[model samples]
Target: MNNAKKYNIKIAIAVALLLSAASFTFLEKQEINSKDNLMEVLYALGQDYPEHYIEKPDSANIKRGYELIHVGKTKSADGIASKAISKFYTCTSCHNVEREDLDLTLVDQDARLEYAMENKLPYLQGSTFWGIVNRESWYNDDYILKYGSLVDDAKNSLKGSIQLCATVCSQGRELEDWEMTSILSYLSTLQMKVEDLELNIAEFEQMNSLAESNPDSAIAFIKSHYLSKSPATFAELPESKEKGYSFEGRPQYGKAIYELGCQHCHHAYGESDLVLDNSVLTFRWLKKHMPDNSKKSIYEIIRKGSYSELGHKEYMPNYTLEKMSHRQVEDLRAYIESNVK
Candidate 1:
């Protein structure tokens, strides 16, 4: 052959090999993606898959649900306004609609505090409503202690739990059929996505490789990354020494918790009779009561929240150790005491 012909043949052969390799790689990726729809994987693993989960929820239902959650009322399809679900508290009073923790796996309050401050979300007593749809159970752990017989029905059934919260916990009436459907549709929109998983590159590759042959391993691995249920362990008020009274609390963090956690229901136009603001009077009252073991003290009120009485249907929900740490409670104290006039 001529020298030019030999060179052209070599180039053609190399190009063919490259194209063949690229095609194989593309096919491999396509196969992986087909199997790696985490939602399907979770469903196959018997992960409490909903009967009907739509990728896109109905916009009007979502709007009504959102309004109901935030304001305790919404308009029906006919443009008629529904009655308030609760006169005292809306869903947002104790729960944030957005994600609170930076890492989904860790329920660490400090990390959650940082994320809440960064994202401008309330550091609430209840778990965030962001991924509530994906969670297998609700009103978990020591919540049974407070709810008593009510928790029995709600422990496993999402709809049952929603009704429990609406009627018992929130002191509202039982939700109507349409209202229940709308709220659930809204929650379904908040289901966890694949990006929320903590898979490393190597782990992702392993899952991709093992997807067909050893799929159970990948399923279990994904499940391990996040909790199916939020834990709630109620704690007692700390003793004087264990309260970390000596340690200087971070006022900046404390301020965020106060505004986001406390003032959400305790400010002017908020749900609480004991209104809280930047006013000197509020600060002074909190400071004066801090040394005592009264409900007015942050230490007492936070750990041992008030319960509903005959006349008082509205009551404070106690913070779980998982929800608010001892340090964060102290941080709240520092912030309140700092503002004392």
Candidate 2:
């Protein structure tokens, strides 16, 4: 080949390489800039995405909220205590503060039991407060039947629901405005982190790609990954004497439900007078009285929870099908039988 042709070919290849390097640099810069947008988009669409969340929660307010939830009262820096929120129950009596299920979309009792065991938390009736701020609805499903007209006002409003729980559910008075603000501020701090979504690589890429051009689609996509609201369905007590599952129940799993779910409210430091420890007597009592039509039976009590009378304001909340499955109840029976034997 001619020397002039060879020189032209070398120059062409050099320009191509330089252009490729410049393109790579530009793409890297674009990705870096989009990182912030990625977080914004994820949080907007992620689980527990409340309509409005405080970006910065006040530490003082958070402490007050914490105290109110665990203790049902707030204390001043000077150590004076505010009026108790409830005579019967604190928020922690029924609700957990952390995530309960492996997947936010799942409402399985077995999975929740496992989660509780893992996290050292008690299995309770109410949903967790971890993402309460993000939930669009509250006091859902059968709650309407219990609360009646009150549910109407609380269903769509978080503040309303809080008030309903405080007055009716907790058997407490209405919260002061500042108290409400502080509780909300504390809940805001519990917003789900981006990592909680567990987005895969391709999903992360899609999120990044749509972070700017079409955020609505991205938001919908992420929302689809987790439940926007926890569901509740009441289960009727079994008609016949037999309530066991066809398959054998796992006594180990049932043991957890007994300890975390039953013992949580029955033992010392719990809400109930009935003391259920790791005793053979408790097991024998459960085995003999297991799940009949009687309200004292495990099955009947779980399905049709007892109502509070004038003398007792604190009452057991019935477990929804979503909270405790038929299989789980059978498992509890199996556990009791095992202990009795």
Best candidate (score: lDDT): 1
The digit string of per-residue lDDT tens for model 1 on 128-196 reads 887787777888999888889899878887888888888977899998877887786666555555556
Clashes of each: 0, 1
Candidate 1's TM-score reads 0.84
RMSD (Cα, Å) for all candidates, in order, is 14.2, 16.3
Model 2, CA-based lDDT: 0.72
Candidate 2 C-alpha lDDT tens digits along 68-91: 776688875567778999988889
Regions of model 1 farther than 4 Å from truth: 1-38, 44-48, 51-56, 241-247
Pull out the clashing pairs in model 1: none
Error of 1 at 10 (Å): 62
By TM-score, how accurate is candidate 2?
0.83
lDDT scores of the candidates, listed in order = 0.74, 0.72
